[model samples]
Target: MSPLLDTLSNAVGAAHVLTHDDPGADLSAWEQDWRQRARGRALAVVRPGSTAEVAAVVRACAAAGVSIVPQGGNTGLVVGSVPDGSGTQVVLSLTRMNKVRAIDAANLTITVDAGCVLQAVQDAAEQAGFLFPLSLAAEGSCTIGGNLATNAGGTQVLRYGNARELCLGLEVVTAQGEVWHGLSGLRKDNTGYDLRDLFVGSEGTLGVITAATMKLYPLPAAQLTAWAAVPSLDAAVQLLGLAHQHLGAGLTGFEVMGQFALSLVAKHFPQQRVPLWDEHPYCVLLENSDNESEEHARAQFERLLETAFENGVVSDAVVAENLQQAHALWHIRESIPLAQAEEGLNIKHDISIPVSKIPAFCAETDALLQHEVPGVRLVNFGHLGDGNLHYNVQAPEGGDAKAFLRTMEERVNTLVFDAVARYDGSISAEHGVGSLKVDKLPGYKDPVALGLMRAVKQALDPHNTLNPGRVLSA
Candidate 1:
């Protein structure tokens, strides 16, 4: 065994460390991603069960001058979890540390180890008669550590906020093997610099997030789901304003999808029929919640729809009558990614602009792409409430997906990112600047901001040992 592997085995345990040549015990499901970007090999996969064990593993790696890649559920959209083919880095898998240490329902907080699966946390919250409202497509498998690492945003972000906002404190293990225990559930602590926020979205580059205390919300007593067909993106935006004004705090989610994107879902998932007008140009999935009767929530949703229709914002509408029907309506929205995957490989982008600028951004970018790359198939959809969109472009029919991707990836990214910058939007919204977007960051991010990121990274991980060559390249 290599000296480094032997040291890691001794630090954690012999059984906790699997050597590089052990074939890794089949990580196909864990290794692959929703996007199928690329994969890499690790020198060893270490499963540490506690914060102390994680610190020990990190100390060992730091002493050996070997790199460590911190991983959670491995469901990240970018290739952040997977190592490069060099096989020199150790994959520090935190799955074994999955545990809910404490749930202070009265305090409205839950302290959990980073390895705990998101769904498990949600289940724990539900059992406590509360709601951990971080909803995402990959919640079943994605881990809280990964969620915080990426600062994930989802449908509930409009109401509950993103992972960063939901987090109150964190327990991080720095590169030097020391645990920085900041897991305070206190809501008001003007103690000092907000160190927790730095590591929350650092993507494991600055330090290893061992555990966290996340905020919880009161469970909603009622939920209303509606599907509305809008004549145009402008109408969809107008509808959103109306809902906000009328529904106020009850308005939770507002998702807008172009007709073409919805058509793909209908085509791929035939079981999920179109929810609104068959030939509408755009569709909006609106969700509302109230702490009162379901009938009251439904009535409020109906009022919003009625106002939208009267104002010429909504051409048609359908309100879900039951939970099953509500899920079916949401299924159409969630199935967009699955449907796109079934169709073919495409250049995908996660971008966000001002909520009001979305209509113009979509219109201008669509025209530019069509004019630049003839026959480009566009699939655009996402949370309009937060101004983030998944802008994807599939290769023309009969074109080679892989070959097209290889030749046009850079050019395509430039097109989308340039347009995003023009609108003062971000190239990365929910999906982070994992290894994929690290190269493109410097151009988009301010020099001062980038420099400060580098400085923080240097202060926490001077040796560039933790998740090296990711987020901020070495």
Candidate 2:
């Protein structure tokens, strides 16, 4: 252990290798997840400044027979990036390798280090007169590496696609400390196996993502946002179909929020002024990005809403007059998770059902949950355009929230995940199968699919040297 630590210290400066042995050294930021759901004890937190340094650290850990957990931003909801309590695993932190390697405007691609923040990448692209559209609430702190590792889907995924689709290439450090310099801006390459796709969503189990070349799009001439009051979940689904029909490729974002979910925001964050949530069972946030003028975008949104009203899918609606208003509306939608936290401890499930079957699935699942746990509250909201729902469960009013979570989390997860399986939906939509949901995969995932995944893991990292006990058991 001492020799390995010495080697790591030599590879990436002694200051980069953090350990409890260093006086006044605090590793809490690297140890605990943002949600506070997990806190790990790492043997050491190794910050590598370059891909070469990452490979060196991986080699050192592999030679010592010590497992490594690759982390970026430390903003992940699942306990995938943190080390276990054993205090024997090395945490390979990528935040130090933050850099924008290249931006080929003609090629419409932006290559960046895995440690580069998502927001920074967006800003870089914007500065160069382009748009990098992978966005979520955690963009401020989340890293591109982590985003690709999880194959994250955000608000713009309806038109732009997930991180995997946006990514054209990846620079990964294999488990054996070898560098795969596959980064490129090429859009078409039928040369062989798609290794980039394999590592994009592998969640650090297969290899360490050092950097990536992500797709970019031209900045829209006009971007308009609207919030509509929906009578029910079915109405929301109808409105979504209408949006696709009317807005066509112009539609970039379509988010659905249940009335209860908005109510939580109203109760916890009174300043944001939630709209039309009191009278409707659901409300949707829609975005239209047009290549034409702002007036054209506004007109398209108006036509969509008018049709929605005539069809009785939307009872009321409000379109943002400016960028500030648009951001405010988005802020309210993003505040759901925080508001839930302010209210109390809750069980969160990231699941996806076919767009057409969402309403029915929610109806059945809601009833089953209410019957099973009387008075349990459901917080439902997510990117409806992509069919992903952050269908979270909250404890009943005026009860021990912590106690509810302690005793009922497993039961609730089973109930929700079982329903997801019945609907032919995935239990994990954008959130990868971290240590939290690793065990749940067997029952929900197809036997053949699970076997194939296991085979891939064995083939990629046979000794489980990278992120062991993550997507699969060791």
lDDT against the true structure, per candidate, is 0.89, 0.94
Which candidate has the top score in lDDT? Answer: 2
Candidate 2: how many backbone clashes?
Answer: 0
Model 1 lDDT per residue over 45-106, tens place: 88888999899999989998888889999989877887777778888899888899999978
Per-residue lDDT over 150-234 for candidate 2, one digit per residue giving the tens place of the 0 to 100 score: 9999899999999999999999999999999999889999999999999988999999999999999999999999999988888
lDDT of 2 at 415: 92
Candidate 2 to truth, TM: 0.99
Compared with the true structure, model 1 gives a TM-score of 0.97
**Model 1 — which ten-residue stretch has the worst lDDT?**
26-35
Highest TM-score model number: 2
